[model samples]
Target: MTPGALAEGRPEARGPRFRVVVETGPDARQEIPLEGTLLVGTQVEGGLRLSDPTVSRVHLELQARPEGVRVRDVGSRNGTWSLGVRIHEVTLAGEARFTLGKTTLLVMPEPTEEAAEPAPRTTFGRALGQSAAMQKLFGVLERTARSSFSVLLLGETGTGKELLAEAIHRASPRSNQPFVIVDCGAVVPSLIESELFGHAKGAFTGAHADRRGHLVQADGGTVFLDEVGELPLELQPKLLRVLESGTVRRVGDNAAKDVDVRVVAATHRDLKAEVAAGRFRADLYYRLAVVPVRVPALRERAEDIPLLARHLFQQAGQPDFPLTEELVQRLMGYDWPGNVRELRNFVHRVLAAGDAELPDTRPVSAVTAAEDLSGLTFKEAKERMVEAFTREYLTALLARCGNNISEVARTAGLARSHVHGLLNRYGLKAGD
Candidate 1:
């Protein structure tokens, strides 16, 4: 969904009384009368007690006036903002929006006698970055939204592939239709087919009644197949048939049922190598990859780390904790082996510890004691250090990519043969 589409709540009226709605947390909504001045802060007495630490005890004061509502910042650490610009005070002639720390406030002019219903909230809205990479991704999404061709999103885990899929759906003509998700990795192979193509009553031992699978259920809509690379080899042909014929044949049923579902698949694995390895079908790969889009890894966009960290910090309810330059530098220097997900977890750990000091990002060999290196020749020690770093790096890389050799190779920018050699040389299994 577009960022603007996330605006929530609306003005409410009770009988002859008018009130302005304030939405704080994800689903918390409150209505306050526009008859008197209201204080918003962390204090218990404030009309709106925002629990965020970035908010001062008396963060903002809003006074209702004949002309409009007057808003003044009451010395908040993070200050206040109107439409994205920082301001100490501003008068709203009518409706306006403002931000205090992590919270957003919408001031509605006194509601009329007839109250309009609030707009529906979108399933996806958070636009986390303004980096060039993100801008390019947005452009691709906008273009893909207008087409019915299948999409293949290539990215590391935690790169927000699912979120992008939702954005594409919300921007498409079928925005009002259902968007179904199928996690191929999580589904058991035995049940994968039945789950994607439903069965008739008594089709199998446990077939209790007739049911429509995700594809049929999502007819006229979109279906996101997450971790599509994990789909079983045996099932790949069936999926390809469905995509080709736009029909599905339920197990134990002869009749083929028509479906009109848009398919969007995502994976961290490199399907080209998978096909070469005889693990995935080349035809299915080509079908799903009509439009391939890559979500850039976090390390490739280090410039966006500060913005992402602050955004995540606010979401974690720790806006008061300063995101120091040292911490940001440390974060940027790290490879972010787990990408955005690891950074988020690191932020949570910092907030939980109530400290801004960041952990060391140095390689394990660099932290080894000098005494432990005694007696070894300089060349021998250097070789050992290189091996140590390589082993550690590959281990984390493999783990983050779900131990898929092709994915690890793609992420590491190494040849499939070279990666296989390294795995053998280091005596490291995919799962290791």
Candidate 2:
């Protein structure tokens, strides 16, 4: 029988007895027997250590009391939260819950043995990988899902950022509420403001009726801002204001409407670099990145390639299609510039043509598409080959280093500026 069940069946004990349940990270479902002055933080000496980066060295202290348990925030940078509201200190009892950084804590009386089993594992999605990097990412996702703080997902394109965001919503308390998706990149710059914040009727030439924006549409749930870095510079502050005050004013409207929404923003760009370059606002970055979770790029966890490829193949309606070892090797060998999406497309192409062998790595046909090299000089042909080789080499190098230019330079023994120049010259952007 579970510990909770065991505790439930036992006679009521008179002393202070409770368990602090960690609901996320590597310690999910871990129970700490509450005692006098239990310290929780990222520090090793902490009574309960949480390795999440968002957690401060010393976050909160829980002291056993006659009435219940008293939780005091130890001046944590992000602050302690309960039911989406920040609190300096509060007394908790009877299944009280709170959040510390990216971790969630549940304060409850000791469970009976029948009820003492660990929390059930949450199944996020098929795209949710089983690799170590992905497992860590999911841990952050699970923790962040329990809070209302803004989240920023950073990764290369096709790393399943949107799917991850959806998983978070599904795993959250707001799951039953509306989940609104706003593709900032897809919206026109002219209409983005109105689309996100809504507008009063007649605000613009084409305005026909008063409309609620995506933010309002997601009032009680989550607003997923996909490709959020692509949002226009002029509109960022407005977004930031909403994040700060929980109030959004429609374009050309004087009155502001309050919205209770959890914001989850994602981008392929290195937002820190964008902020450094003055393209992205520093204030906005901090507000969105309260819990920044970096989705792992495909090549980082190559061991999962077979599983992902097989899943994609099955998704393509060819579950029985043979994934030969040679084909699997080729899939794992290439640096997926476009990540999982690229791999899925490759699978589609293979299925479409019913090709039994792996496609050639080189575009030999493209080189010969001109019908002859007679019109081209040997020097030109040599230059084309050299360019292709250089571009391919750099692409692989960038993938290996998680798109960090400094790491790539250090490993290749090249100057930072030189690396940037090469990337620019070859039209190879980082985080592709």
Candidate 3:
């Protein structure tokens, strides 16, 4: 059995902590203590009989193994028709369920408490990769959940921008409220203003009745303005005003109404260049980018491809199916310029194409495109990579010093300030 939902411990990385789920059997309810290893077995009217009675120093030793762990039959003259089974017996690593007689085991591993993080919804259409990048993305989602600031997501199309935006909304305090989504570029140029800011009755042709705008509908929650860079030049000021004043004015109405909503904007275009070209407003950019986050493209975070592919498949809502390691490897090696959204679509497409059969692997070809991206000029892939020496030195020092930067620096004949600067430069903090 694995473990259950848990808080992350240790500085696994500069990210969320994780735990695992393990199952003993059914009728074996137990909780993982905050400390110590978890054990589950039946209480024999007393405590465990062992040479070491170390329960005092232990955190928890909960065991309620099913009859499957020790199958036995009861005496009955009429005979009994009962089902007893023991389906799995693996050490704790991931979550799974096992059968044991009348009872079953449900093992769980909290690999990050990661399910809660929200992915930014993007206009991207392709996703590729399987590696640390996916983990990092989840970590980003976890971190974003702790704040309510306006988040500006930057990523190319097919990058799952909108997905992340919704994740943030769901993880936010306003999850229960309206999560209004609007495509700034999707609106026809002539109708963009009317669509975002509600139009009053008779405001314009086809304005038959008073209608609520996307901003107002998201009054108590979040407004995801995808492709925000496409917002018309004329509409920029009004949008900024609403962001600044928390008010949305209808087209035909002279008065403005107050609204309580968080604005999360996303666009692949470079806002800075857009501002310079007079295509985007600088003030609005500042207001919306209180927390600017760049969604790493598929190729950039390829390490997370396997996990993402698995998750995207699961997200398909299909029960009782798992992906194979071979398929996962093919996916992990791909270059996903499209990012997570692409991966989701690929999973959906694969499931639909082969009904989840392992043979049908068009998804593999889609990811092989990563090689294409990789072949591009070095300038094309502006990724930050640690030098081999720096990585080895840092790893060795931290391990030897028990992750103490001061101690490592002292032993290595380096100034603490320089070491701290290096750690900061490399995105390494204490514990990692």
Which candidate leads in lDDT? 2
Residue range with the least summed lDDT across 10 consecutive positions in model 1: 1-10
- In terms of TM-score, the best-performing candidate is 2
Q: What is the lDDT of residue 193 in candidate 1?
A: 90
Candidate 2: minimum summed lDDT over ten consecutive residues — where? 111-120
**What ranking of all candidate models by TM-score puts the best one first?**
2, 1, 3
CA RMSD per model (angstroms): 22.9, 12.7, 23.5
Model 3, residue 87: C-alpha shift (Å): 75
TM-score, predicted candidate 1 vs. hidden true structure = 0.58
| Candidate 3 residue-wise lDDT, 1-432, digit = tens | 111111111233332112212222233333232122333233222322122222122212332231112112222122212124322232232223433233333332222222223334321123323344444455555555445657788876656778778877887788899989898865777988888888999999899999988888889899999889878898898887787667888999998999998888898778879877978865566557655667767667666666566566667886445667877776766554334544665577677776433222234334344355465566653331224346545654554444556556644658789888878876776554
| Tens-digit per-residue lDDT, 302-380, candidate 1 | 8878888888988998777676678778777877767777677667667677544443445666655533766799998
Cα lDDT, all candidates: 0.73, 0.75, 0.56
Q: What lDDT, from 0 to 1, does candidate 2 have? A: 0.75
The C-alpha stretches of model 2 lying farther than 4 A from their native spots are: 1-123, 355-432
